[model samples]
Target: MPLFSNKFCPKKPTPRKVELSVLNKELGPEKALQDLGLEIGPIRLKLGDQESLFDNGEWLPETGPVSGTHKENHKLRQYVQQLEDENNLLKLKYEILLDMLTQTTAESHLQEKQMEQLQKQVLNSSRIPRTKR
Candidate 1:
């Protein structure tokens, strides 16, 4: 009987070892592997490696301002404006109400004076004392 069968044979052979130095120099190791669609978690460099190569090349110095912060500031300003408008409206309404109350009070006082004069005339004609004990 035959010990091996052709069914178990691999369709393609894979290379086990690769040249690291040439690959590292050509693609700077990080970019080369990324270009090939490889994902390596944070690359750790040896103490002897070049510091500039390890530093992130895409760092920005003055990131300026974030849009969210500006948006929040704008929203805060709008809210303050709304509150001020509400306060002004309430103040105007309060003044109108106060004026109405003052007019009502003055009218009530005039009515009270007229009623007192009518009562005095009725008492004088009927000869009755209007004094309260």
Candidate 2:
């Protein structure tokens, strides 16, 4: 607590100052900031006014308008080509699976017909009487 209020005194308030005496003296302010991963620099803030909005900050690409557009177009074309290649591969896989399914169905149907023929041959032989020799 103060002995007397500053309102009655003629002394003015001085600015506050800090000093890291013992443990932090070895690591200075810059080293401490680096250790904490803090950077002290002029940061580019998104301003509401058009003063530096159009100015090339870190967000804007350092390229001409036409070149940037061309680069975007090239990326889109590459993406489209990749998608087309994937579509063709999927179509090829679908055709191969369809052909395999068709072949399996045909083989199953043929096996069913063979089973019916064997059953008929057994029934016909049982109906006939065998002569004693």
Candidate 3:
């Protein structure tokens, strides 16, 4: 069955057995493999054997700046903090706007009521009958 693969990375047929082709080219000095604790290449066995071969290769050192991993982590942490700060600032601005809107609405309502009361007072005073001289 054909398997789906990324366009950038086409799938390759897994070799059942790996072989040593040239003396100096693909296969170097045999002692180098032994020193690295890698099983002799041109090897054949179950697929699981490949894992050990991969593990045997040299890895990053225990100390020193390793591939700027710490720097990346620091940048991520700072970014999260900055986002949080901006979110909080937005919330504060939203609350202030809401409060301003509430105050303006209340002021307008109070003015409307006062205007109605003044109109009623004026009408009542005019309706009062004046005594004839």
Candidate 4:
């Protein structure tokens, strides 16, 4: 029996039975973190004196009612309201600008009509018979 025989060689095996989660099925953890404006890094998890570090943190359960989340949400809401007010003001200004433009256009049309009438009158007068004086 040969020691280095073809039977001893490792065969090219197929993929094993591995399960993929829903999140993994979709746009991956890295993409999900990016969408949520978070950086990829190690996460610390504790389970009654047992601490573990994980590369992916999206799956980690939140610490529930985080004070930082509340503060951030409060600030976000305030900024949103401010932006809404600014948008309303911009809308009002846009309406005013549109009205002014419409009024100016109407006035220009009226002036053009008046000029046309004056030109017609001058032409008519020139064509009319006049006494030699």
Model 2, poorest ten-residue lDDT window? 47-56
lDDT of each: 0.72, 0.73, 0.68, 0.76
* Tens-digit lDDT track of model 2 for 23-116: 3688887787788555755534443431111233534333445446756877899999999999999999999999999999999999999999
TM-score of each: 0.47, 0.50, 0.45, 0.51
Query: What is the per-residue lDDT of model 3 for residues 20-132, given as tens digits with 9 covering 90 to 100?
Result: 35433555767546655566453222333221112245332223454267557768999999999999999999999999999999999999999999999999999998889
Cα lDDT, model 3, residue 120: 99
Q: Candidate 1: list runs displaced more than 4 Å.
A: 1-65, 128-133
How does candidate 4 score on lDDT?
Answer: 0.76
Q: Write the per-residue lDDT of candidate 1 for residues 31-128, one digit (tens) a residue.
A: 88788767755444433322212227532222224434655777899999999999999999999999999999999999999999999998898897
RMSD of 1: 15.7
Worst 10 residues of 4 by lDDT: 58-67
Q: Mind giving the per-residue lDDT tens digits that candidate 4 earns over 14-129?
A: 98874546555686878767775557466777666444455454433334445357558778999999999999999999999999999999999999999999999999999999
The lDDT leader among the candidates is: 4
Candidate order by decreasing lDDT: 4, 2, 1, 3
Tell me how far the alpha carbon of residue 76 in candidate 3 is from the true structure, in angstroms, after superposition: 2.1
